[model samples]
Target chain A: MPIITIRLAKGRSVEQKRDLARAITNTVVEKLDVNPEWVTVLFDEFDRENWATAGELHSDKYGKGFGKIGSQEYPK
Target chain B: MPIITIRLAKGRSVEQKRDLARAITNTVVEKLDVNPEWVTVLFDEFDRENWATAGELHSDKYGKGFGKIGSQEYPK
Candidate 1:
């Protein structure tokens, strides 16, 4: 059994989480052909200070936000 | 490097967490022969509602408490 653990900045509502869990379960069941009941989606919420990228803490870089919109090091 | 993620009911103090991290890191270093810095120990705290065992929610079964001290399903 595959356990999918999602680590993200905590802000989503319960409805959003329910939708996410259902969608993820559906995707996994379709792709892996596993039973819906067997799929476990665990959400690990993290503070910006706990997450670091490019040797800089997200709290220091983003100042408490979920998306990586403006703090792009290289232009697209 | 191996990443160890521990899922548990959240109630431990900061000092307990610090000691746990250090002890785990040391154990990983000794067992796996990896660098201490390379071993990552992430604590994923969960509410009793989110964790289920034997098709029953922990919140409903145990109220609000940590440890399996009294919960003896089978005698040792």
Candidate 2:
């Protein structure tokens, strides 16, 4: 069994997150020969203010977007 | 903006987690002179089976602890 934990700012859509998880899980499951049930994935999402990039907080420093990912669906 | 991403297994108390975040935030704030509001902290909780240490998943490979961190307090 393997567990994958990923932390990224909340901006990507449900499709993106789900696809990312699926791709990651599938890669590890096949490579490590682990059972599907053993593969657990968690995505930690944070607001721009809570997350930072480069040298500033994503909110104050990078207002590239706002309130972007509040209604994203989680992929199973 | 600078984003710091950390990945760790979920077996810490709310106090512990809050304390950890506070310490981290205080460190960055003092050292970097950044505003407290700019410091956003997030904790992603996962089951033992969803985490891994050494060469095994946190669950099957290590049951040394279980249901350990669920009802702790989350400090502000």
Q: What is the TM-score of chain A alone in each candidate?
A: 0.82, 0.70
Residue B5 lDDT in candidate 2? 47
Per-model TM-score versus the true fold: 0.53, 0.44
Per-candidate DockQ values are: 0.08, 0.10
How far is B9's C-alpha from truth in model 2 (Å)?
Answer: 21
lDDT of 2: 0.60
Per-residue lDDT tens digits of candidate 1, residues A1-76? 6577777775555555566666777888889987766766666788779988999997787875565644333212
Model 1, residue B43: C-alpha shift (Å): 6.8
Query: What DockQ would you assign to candidate 1?
Result: 0.08
How big is the positional error of residue B40 in model 2, measured in Å on the Cα after superposition? 10
Clashes per prediction? 0, 11
Question: Per-residue alpha-carbon lDDT of model 2 for B1-76, expressed as tens digits?
Answer: 2233445555554445445666777777788888766665555456667877687876676553544433332223
* Candidate maximizing TM-score: 1
